[model samples]
Target: MTIDDHKSHLVTLGKFLKQFQVTGSKKDEEIPGNDRFFEDFDQKIDNAIHYNGWFTRENIIFALQQWSEALTPQNLKWWLGDYNLNQSGGKTVGIVMAGNIPLVGFHDFISVLVSNHKVLVKQSSHDKQLLPVIAAYLMNLDSRYENRIEFTKGKLEDFDAVIATGSDNTARYFEYYFKGKPSIIRKNRNSVAIITGNETKEELAKLGEDIFRYYGLGCRNVSKLYIPKDYNFDNFFQAIYEWNPIINREKYANNYDYNKAVYLMSEFKLLDNGFLMLKEDKNFGSPIATLFYEIYSDETELEKNLEEHSEKIQCVVKLHPGKKEVKFGHTQKPQLWDYADNIDTIDFLSIL
Candidate 1:
C-alpha cells in the first residue's frame, strides 16, 4: 500500500475506534465494517480486561479514544509530513510489545506498517488479545495489510530490525540478542511531577488524573513528585480525593495494603489518604498504589538533576513547558509525534 492508502485505512480504523469511548460505546452506522467488526471489537475489550486485570474497561476505552484522536487524516499527514518514505519499505521489523497498559505497543505496530515496512509482532502474553482484534480490523479494511502484519507466540525470526520494550533486565537480553541488527531496545522509565506549591486546585485535580489513570500502570503515569520543601499534603490529597474510589479495585487495594504494611513495618514515614500513599523517596519508579516524593531546595538544581537523569525518566510534569517537560495532566495523552524514550520511531524506520 502507498502512504496515502495506509493513511486512509488508519483513518477508517480511527473512526471505528471512536465509537468506543469512556462515556459509553456508540456505534456509528456510517463507518464501514461496523456491522462486521464493531461487536467483535467490543467483546475483545471485555476479553482483554479478563485476560489481564490491569486492563480495565475505562483504561482500554481511554486508550482507544486517544488513538482515535491521533489517527485522523490531518494527524497522519502531519506525523509523516517530514519523512521521505517513497523508496523506503519492504523490510520486516519485529516488535516486542510490553503489556504494562492497554494497547501500549500499538504505536510501534502502526509505525512499521505506515512506513511501508512489514511487521512481526510478539505481544506480551498479558496483553495478547486486543491487538490481534485490531489487526483483524485492519486486514478487513484492506487485504494488503494481511501480508504486512503477522503475530507469533514463539520466537521472532527473519526480521531485519527489532523494537523491544521491557524492564531494565530484559533490555539487557534484547541488547545482547539483537546486537548486530538495527534495534530500539527500551528499558524501564518512570514519569514524575514537579509541584511548586502554587498550583491551583484545578491543576492539582488534573494532576490527579495523571497519577490515577491506568491505575498508575503506564510509564507516563506520574509515579514520583518533586515538591517544594514546605509543600503541604492537604491540598494535594483533597484535590485527588475524586479518585479515592480507585481503592475499591481489588488488585490496587491489595498493592496499597501490602506496600503500606511494608512501609509501616519498616517505620518509614508516609502520608496516606486511604487510596494513595506518598513517601519521601528519591527514586523515580514508585511501587503501585504509592507515589515517591522528594523535597527540592532549588528549582534550577531540580531541573538540572532531571536533565542529568533524563534517560531514567519518561516524562517530567510541571506547569511550565521547558525542555522535555509536559503540562500538568497531558503525559498520558501524548500526540502522535511524542516518541517514547525520546527516540523517533518513524525516523528510525525511514532510515531502515
Candidate 2:
C-alpha cells in the first residue's frame, strides 16, 4: 500500500477510537467497519483494566482520546509531510514495549508502519490487551495491515532493526543482544517540574495533573520537584487538593500507606496530606503516591546542573523560562512529533 493508503486507514481507525470516551461510548455512523470492532472495543477496554491495576478506566479513556486526536488526517499529513516514503524496501522492525502506562509504545508501532515497515511487537504483559485490539481494527480497515503487523509472546526473531524500552538494567541486555543490528534501546528516565514560587494557583493546579496522572506510573509523569529555597508548600497543597479523590483507589492508597510507614520508621522528615507525601530527595524517580523535592537557590545554576545531567531527564516542565520546555500539565499529552528520548523514530525507520 502507498503512504496515502496507510494514512487513510489510520484516520479511519482514529474515528473509531473517538467513539469511546470517559463520559460514554457512541457509535459513529460515518466510520465504516465499526460494526465488527465496536462491540470488541468495549470488551478490550474492560480486559485492559482488569489485567493491569494502573490501567484505570479514566486513564484508558484518556489514552484513547489522545490517540484519536493525534490520528487525524491533517495531523498525520503534517507530521509526515517532510518524510520521503517513495523508496519502498521496507524492513521488519521489532518493538519491545513498556507497560508503565496504557498504549505507551504505540508511537513506535505506528512510526514503523507509517514509514512503510512491518512491525513485530512484543508487548509488555501488563499491557497486552489494548494494542492488539487496535491493530485488529486497523487490519479490518485495510487487509494489507494484516501482513504488516505482528505480535510475539516468545523470542523476537527475523527483524532488521529493533526498538526496546526498559529500565537501565534491561537496557544492558538489549544493548548486548542487539549489538549487531541498528537499534534504539531506551533506559529509565524521569520528568521534573521547576517551581518559581510565583506560579498562579491555576498553573499549580494543572501541575498537579502532571504529577498525579496515570497514578504517577508513566515516564512523563513529574516525579520530582525543583522549588525555590524556603518556599512554603501551602499554596501548592491547596492547589492540588482537587485530586484528593485519587487516594480512594485501593492500589494507590496501599502505596501511600506503605511508603508513609517506611518513611516514618526511618525518621525521615516528610510533608503528608493524607494522600500524597513530599520528601526532600535529590533523586528523580520517586515512588508512587510520593513526590521527591529539592530546593534550588539559583535558577542559572539549576539550569546548568540539569543540562549536565540531561540524559537522566525525560522532560523538563517549566513556566515561560524562555527555553524549550514542556508547558505545565502537558507532560503526558505529547504530540505526534514529540519523539520519546529525543530520538526521532520516523527518521530512524526512514533511513532503514
Give the best candidate by TM-score.
1
209-328: candidate 1 lDDT, tens digit per residue:
899999998899999999887888898998899999899999999999999999999999999999999999988999999999999999999989998999999999998768668998
Query: Judged by lDDT against the true structure, how good is candidate 1?
Result: 0.92
Show where candidate 2 strays beyond 4 Å: 321-323
Clashes of each: 0, 0
RMSD of 1: 1.0
Q: TM-scores of all models?
A: 0.98, 0.97
Global lDDT of each candidate: 0.92, 0.91
Model 2 worst lDDT run, 10 consecutive residues: 318-327
Give the worst 10-residue stretch by lDDT in candidate 1. Answer: 320-329
Tell me the lDDT of model 1 at 35: 89
The C-alpha stretches of model 1 lying farther than 4 A from their native spots are none
